[model samples]
Target: MTSRTLPRLLQTPAVLLLLVWMLVPLGMTLFFSFIRYVLNSLRRPEWTSPSIDNWRGWGNYEYVLYSAKDFWFAVQNSLFIVGSVIALTVGLGLAIAVLVNRNFMGRGIARVMLISPFFVMPAVNAVLWINMILDPVLGLNGLAVEGINAIVASLQTMPIFGGFFSLWPEIEPVSFRATQTSAMAVIIMVTWQWTPFAVLIFMTSLQSEDQQQKEAAILDGANAWSQFRNLTLPHLARPIAIVVMIQAIFHLSLYAEIEIVSRGNGNKNLPYLIGEFASNNIGAASATGIMAVVLANIVAIFLLRIIGKSLMD
Candidate 1:
């Protein structure tokens, strides 16, 4: 036997085990998606179990796509939250990475502090943000707005500026838990937690950047913006792609933050919707799970193309 044949034989068991590990659950999900499976069905007890006699075919898919009122909204909200979080994290990450790349006092402490948010558990992060930072009455948000309004009130009593200050309307603290703004709260808290991940990735990439090129650009009288645009940005292309791809995959499946922030009130993503379905209707939940898998694959493929192009460049 050839040397390569021995290696392949040794690797066979692991490859088969990995395949079984992935494919079994996937196969089960697919099977249940096509059958009328439920956790509790008193009216039709047979529907509670998985049986070929209770085949649903495309029924569950149709139910989710048309019968479920929130399916479309959940899809849209999922995309929106993912898109918003990715954009904010990338922008803020790049900014912070660049700022901290410079030599400054307490640089080590600053880096540690910046990355601390990422280590916080998702549920705890959401709780801290909603209660301590974003709460409408007791949080810093309320205090800051109240302070501004108080200052405006004090200024209105001044004779010369009384008329001008009166023109300033009292600012109300925004209720982030409300239906209209709950999604924004999810986006905000998620961005806060995940931006550090992007920062870490970009900061590492920046360190590997060729300083000789930067010095050359400086000698050529290139301004900060010019150096960033021409030299730094290109160097970070692959890293940015890596960040975006990973964040897209993760944020698409966000559940804990959504659950805690609003209990899936107006911020239901695909995963949250699946949980709602799984409470009773396993078939619908499985269907949703399959659809989520599809959506994730589509995004992964699209991002893979972009990452490939970046690597090629």
Candidate 2:
């Protein structure tokens, strides 16, 4: 009946609810990872069911790590895609934030337009970018390339300038859907969608920066780049770290965009690889899921350490 005791008791329900919410699926995933739980088996139909008799100690893990050809590539590609998106988003976000932080005409409108991408459904974003923007043959990419070639052709018709213009080769738009380039497509689209989130966070952080300190730095002959590099950047370190961590965690689970864009192509990340395995091999899929969780946790731990250090300073 003590005050503190009652407060702790009141919080217990919420804590228990959250634990159950997280632990149930996690427990199932772990259990499935260690057993032979395929979706179908014509000869050994019993293998389709989950039973103690189907125990497989470390076989699934071994298979995923050593046997599955796509597992390693998927993991590597996942990390590459997440890292590229984080770099591009943080860089573009910081620049855009700085550009729009100052008062200007239609600033509110511009902010809304930029943020609109973040709110778009992931599926729609994927469709729009792939079909309307990056399709090499029919999209804006091809059109722009064709327009440039036309202008070059016109310039080549000029008698004196013909020789000079003819020396230039014709350009072709790059196809982002192929195996060699699908990862780049995902990175570009995700960056476009997430940069606004970074911009919003950075802009908020910018407002809290000490203007007087900036003015003092200006008086002390610190130039624009110096102010940003020394003053503005240091002030934004925490926000930048937070933005990177959040984006990393989200992008690690990216599935829909990859599914749509890289369907037949050889491009695959952890989530996509898991989906492929899950088509028949439930055990392998669960193992891949566990591995993905471990990878994500390692990244999260590293990022949290960085954020902790930034906050402390």
Candidate 3:
């Protein structure tokens, strides 16, 4: 075989596999989205199976966009969660990466401890955080508050400070399982699990920073902030953007953590909403799934452009 032909033959299987992987499910989702398919319908059982006879055109999409109560809420929540996670992980990652970049004793151990959280299963992370750390009555939050209140109560008995301490109201431990707090729980757990990933990436990028440039800046009397602003931030720009988009993609479909933390009680992102629709309304689910694809692609296009530019540089 000629070299060109041999290379094409070798690449064919992967290309075909990717095409199948991308198109087959997507095609089915598109078809189902436009048809009145569902898992259950007692009055009109014919609608239970997918058939071209029940084609819905834009009905499903309109239902999802305008009629479904959770559609906009889920979209907003998804963006909110992804945005918060990106902001937090990037900010904390920068500070931690800079602090730990320099060689120090026990640095390896520190790095291990720092990065370990990233490898944890999302469900386990959420469970451990919500149940073990954030539970109002049984977790550390409550215990810490209880301990503080105990200290204050003891202080109230002291003659010198009794009047001052007695005037303080009791503190309450926040129940993160509640409606408003559930989103906070998901955010905290996701941030804890992902910040380490950001740290690892940023730290790796920091190692490649130009030491000579930094030294020159120092000799030129550039302060730490000035050097960071002029040198490090510029160098980190692409990585920062990459990190934000990468985390955004990962968090957009966040499921296991939301399930474990809130179970869609007070918070549901887009993926979770799709899962809810998938239970009985296949048409709505498929339509929402298609919209999800569109949203992901929008973000991916911008991300790929940045990545491509970085690759060229």
Residues 1-313 of candidate 2: C-alpha lDDT, one tens digit per residue: 8779988998999999999999998999899999989999998898899887999989999999999888999989999999999999999999999999999999999889989999999999999999999999899998999999999999999989799999999998999988869899998899989999999999999999999999999999999999999999999988888898888889999999999999979899999999999999999999999999998897799787887776866
Off by over 4 Å in 2: 1-13, 302-313
Ranking by TM-score: 3, 2, 1
Better candidate by lDDT, 2 or 3: 2
Error of 1 at 49 (Å): 0.7
Cα lDDT tens digits, model 3, 98-150, are 89999999999999999999889887898899988999989999999999999
TM-score winner: 3
Candidate 2 TM-score, C-alpha based: 0.93
> lDDT of each prediction vs. the true structure?
0.93, 0.92, 0.92
- Model 1 off-target regions past 4 Å? 1-17, 302-313
For candidate 1, the TM-score is 0.91
Model 3 residue pairs with clashes: none
